[model samples]
Target chain A: MKFTILINEGPYQHQAADSAYQFAKAALEKGHEIFRVFFYNDAVNNATRLAIPPQDDRNITVQWAELAEQNNLDMVVCIAAAQRRGMLDDDERDRQGKDASNIHPAFRISGLGQLVEGGIQSDRLITFGD
Target chain B: MAMLHIVNKSVFERGTLDSCLKSSLSGSSILFIEDAVVSAVNNTAVSDKIKAELSSKNFYVLTPDLNARGFTDADLIEGIKGVDYAGFVDLVADNSNVQSWL
Candidate 1:
């Protein structure tokens, strides 16, 4: 099976991101393919590289980055959402003349078309939010 | 086609569960996670609403979330099965699509 994940809430503050990550990992471990992980709404915050969680707490951003690297996952952050929430990649930072880019390298900024494509191409589009 | 309708809000706190149940087809599955697990508890104010839908929709609750909220299987309404994180993955795989009520 191929699954596309849609996350709508940020890390730590909500369980949506954590649940989505756990679901994705479980699916991959079961030999299912993760077609993509699309971050929308406050979920775009999950792509920020500046979050420094407590030492004993799980670093949600790092967890996502490691997972993406290990599984070669396609993690997308909606450009519209990212911009609204002040999340910036290198290109966006340069284009907008921002001083810094905070988006984690594991995620790419894209349009909503990526989300649509995931829904169309994947066997199941599972959303974790709120 | 059978779909999975995931509700993650408390019934007392939000009307998301009601909306999800209203929109879900008869054969679809409804899985309660996070704060929504409270809806799966037996003898609650909204338990009747959930019970009424059991004949038409399959009900499920995430065990971890339930436990975290101080609930156990014994407290869950009859006919609502419990699933862990891995079981959540299985539900997604088993269903044709997922509609999360946020």
Candidate 2:
């Protein structure tokens, strides 16, 4: 099946994001293609390239990056959400004259269009949060 | 089929998720919304159960509602996930079916 996942949480905070990860793994293992993974709202913060977690912490940013890299996944973040949470790519930061850019390379900053495209192109679109 | 699960109630609320999850699903999509997104918090039993079920099917969680309620993606542990409004619209469009929980 062609799968599109809408991840709504971060990797450390709770199970939502992580659950999406597990399900992604399952989909891939079952030979399902992951169309795209869209992050919105507070979940958009997961794209921060500068997230600093303690050594004992889960380090969600790195984890998500690694997973996306391994699977060649399309990790998307909502442009609106990222701006509200102070997460921005280099272009966005430069455009807005922000102090820095925090969105990692593994994730792309885009609008809800990607989400719409993913849902339309994929056979199944699964959301993992409220 | 396109289905949305709303996690509206807080994770701690009594029977909030249980009722939603166990509701009739003859052929409906479920998305979690509201405070229930809190259940995605790490080590939460609710997230565990929900994750397990989602692994076998095509259910998903929403993210904007959580953000509006002040919940961050970092608060989630393993199962819950995020989706945008466009994704929601696509789901409704892709599938000729629809239903809502609360």
Candidate 3:
């Protein structure tokens, strides 16, 4: 089955991101297709490359990036939510005339329509949030 | 292709319930869990809206959540059904998709 996972909380602050990561990994391992992992609300923080966690703790952002790289996963961060939280890609940074862009290369910033589209296109739309 | 919309926040505490109700499709089913069970009670400020929505939507409150919050089936608003965890799972299986409104 094709599944779309929606994460609505930032990493570390909530267990939603971890639960979503585990579910996505298990789905892929079970041979199920993950259509997309749409990040919204505080979840856009997951795509920011600026976070630096201690050596002892798991870095969820890096984990997501590696998972996306290995599986060719579509990791999308909602542009509106990203903008609200100051998460920006190169294009957005240039458009907004910002000095830097913190978004990781593995994740792309897109509109909320992608989330609606994912809901329509995928077999299951599983949301993990606060 | 109906959707099962799960709300886990209280209506009085947050706009989550309102947003879920506003965004829901006509035939969608709404299951109130956790703190959202507070909205399923009778004679609340949002009871009128819930009753009105019942004309085109199916409303359910998680029985466990309701009980945990000290509410009974009799306290539920008219047309709202109390469902168990199995019923919640069944609702998810029955719907084409599940949207959790946080």
The lDDT per prediction is 0.93, 0.69, 0.88
Runs off by more than 4 Å, candidate 2: B1-102
Per-prediction tally of clashes? 0, 56, 0
Query: lDDT of model 1 at residue A124?
Result: 91
What value of lDDT does candidate 2 attain over all alpha carbons? 0.69
User: Which has the better TM-score: candidate 2, or candidate 3?
Assistant: 2
Ranking by lDDT: 1, 3, 2
Q: Which 10 residues in a row give candidate 1 chain A its minimum summed lDDT?
A: A21-30
Predicted structure 1, TM vs. truth: 0.95
| TM-score of chain B in each prediction | 0.98, 0.66, 0.97
Interface RMSD of 3: 5.0
lDDT of 3 by residue, B1-102 (tens): 699999978899999988998999899999987678999999988899899999899999988779978989899998999987556656765788788987
Candidate 2 residue-wise lDDT, B13-74, digit = tens: 65656776776353445555555666666666656776666655455455666676677766
Clashing pairs for model 3 are none
Q: State which candidate has the highest DockQ.
A: 1
> What DockQ does each prediction reach against the true complex?
0.82, 0.08, 0.21
Could you tell me every candidate's TM-score relative to the true structure? Answer: 0.95, 0.62, 0.62
Quality class of the docking in candidate 3, CAPRI style: incorrect
Task: Score candidate 2 by DockQ.
Answer: 0.08
